[model samples]
Target chain A: MTKVIAGASMSLDGFIAGPDETGFEHLFRWLGAGDVEVPTANPGHTLRMSAVDAEYLRDQWDNTGAIVVGRRLFDLTGGWGGAHPIGRPVVVVTHEAPTGWEDTPFTFVTDGVTSAIERAKALAGDRWVGVNGGTMARQCLEAGLLDTIGVDLVPVVFGKGVPLFGELANAPVLLGAPEVVVGSGVTHLRYDVLR
Target chain B: MTKVIAGASMSLDGFIAGPDETGFEHLFRWLGAGDVEVPTANPGHTLRMSAVDAEYLRDQWDNTGAIVVGRRLFDLTGGWGGAHPIGRPVVVVTHEAPTGWEDTPFTFVTDGVTSAIERAKALAGDRWVGVNGGTMARQCLEAGLLDTIGVDLVPVVFGKGVPLFGELANAPVLLGAPEVVVGSGVTHLRYDVLR
Candidate 1:
């Protein structure tokens, strides 16, 4: 069975990004905090992380076959400047599919999150459907389609910013105690969404 | 040297309480998730927690000699109804000291967080000063008096609630990677505040 997981680097105060879309340096500092190097799907864009995090990321990328992202993040990152760093097919949830991209690994879903996730799952096979962006994660969570929450918990306080799952409609969403793995400057927490 | 530490049982999304002041049951479920019984200052109030958390709580209580709180929480818990659960004296930071509560473990400080903590430290001697409530913690952190951030992270998402440090004035407060302790229903993270 393919599981849908929401993944992001969050601050100790639970923000994925600081106000004005800042604080990315602190959030993603762990990506370069150590000596071990892990190559990304993008050419010449390898990530250097702690050995523990490198192994963790390697395992995650190995198991995550496809990714589901919101149009905001897709546009913000300019569609990851081409291929996503995770080397997985991306199923974008947008009202309208963007043009000028033909033979890429991007599938633009002109529907809602549910349809986008279904398409991603079909592409994922027995692997996982990785979800990105707070809006996308919240939609998947509220729809009960999110299986896991993968937070690379950084040690910083962004008083206000983009939350991992922003303004959840069905809140008090119970989750299992996270499987914790402490890295150099980040603690990886994998929480299972309870039914 | 006495350390100033802020402690709270926070939701995964950094909330100390849920919307409408709800979600305490989920936040504190770990206090009764196991069989190890830890007695509080109140004769009849004992907490049953997993062995690891019980030890952690015992050590924290043993090390914490004085607790500082905000007036809102002091009135909310009705002054803990008596002595604090950790059997420590409480120094409440308030605009005005309340009357009718003399010779008790509670001391009302009408000055500020710095004065309150100073008084608490004088009362604490060599032991640590524990700061409670988001407002109190935020003040201490901003004043550069906070030494550690002790977060008992519960596995629940409270979409809207009182944050651990609500609306931080000095954000991007970087912290050291936390010392992680995974309990049955909680994960105790001890993060040192970087000066």
Candidate 2:
């Protein structure tokens, strides 16, 4: 069975980002000093993350095969900003084609969720597929195409903004009890898809 | 009035660190981007806080004269290990001094929350005091010591863990509507201390 994992960070109040995505430091602080280390530009503030935490994250990425993302995610992700780190095949599900990165050879399809996922599975072969955006991830969930849903629960709460499963009127998506994994107050939860 | 701003990245479920506190990456992914550049041990993943965001954060810090944290926060924070970036006076409210950073110049107080805060304020000399840590933050909240509460709500939820506020008998804390700031999902909320 081809497994699709919806892995993303969320705030304490059930929001993915704030109104304009401000106060993003809360997200980085959740990463602790270890997940990603950036020297404070202020030079007056110090931060650090546990090394043991970093190794754990690298392992999670190893379980994936291909990645599927939406236009919003594709745009915000800085287009790998001239570099592709994951190296896995990427399938972007979008209504419009992105400029510049067209040379990178990523598959662009407007065939909606199912078709893009099918192509991603084909490219992924025997590996797990990573569902990369909240809305697109919800679409896959609505279609009952997801194999696994991974939610990393962060500790802070944004009163409002985009939600993980933004306003879908589709059929109910049953989820299993999430198995919890803790790192830097970011809880990694996994729910297996049945039916 | 010295105003200290305390902030951190959090998950949707209110978890500071997931199960092992080492496996989750979504918070790191959402944060530490170009806006909040987080430099990773991996040269490839190093990031820097965007000037806009950095300036915003710095502006928040500028209002404070001292910082107050609890025992757990101090311990979990790796004692600002190897890099105590903030030169401002730091007051750690703990039952006992934590090991390792004993040599660090920060004041380690083995006293109650109120006393520690007062001492910090005295040292601050007209500067505002910033308090971090769930227990101490709550303590200040309960004692009606805090003038304002700033919440940088990250979007995610953990079913359980150290709560933002522990059990306080029927007393309620009132928060004002939050203001949208930066990024895709971060929001800043304000709360007036209404005992």
Q: Best candidate per TM-score, number?
A: 1
- Candidate 2: lDDT of B16? 43
CA shift of B120, model 1, Å = 0.5
TM-score of chain B of each: 0.98, 0.76
Give the alpha carbon lDDT tens digit for every residue of B30-142 in model 2: 34545565443234544456565555556655666778888776777666653334446678887877576665547788978888888888877777788876677668867
Off by over 4 Å in 1: none
Q: Which RMSD values do the candidates have, in order?
A: 0.8, 17.5
* Candidate 2 docking band: incorrect
What is the DockQ for all candidates, taken in turn? Answer: 0.87, 0.04
Candidate that scores best on DockQ:
1
Output the TM-score of candidate 2: 0.48
Candidate 2: list runs displaced more than 4 Å. Answer: A35-49, A99-105, B1-195
lDDT string for model 1 (B1-195, tens) is 899999999998999999989999999999998999999999999999999999999999999989999999999999988889999999998898889899999999997889999999999999999999988999999889999999999999988899999777788899987989988999999999997
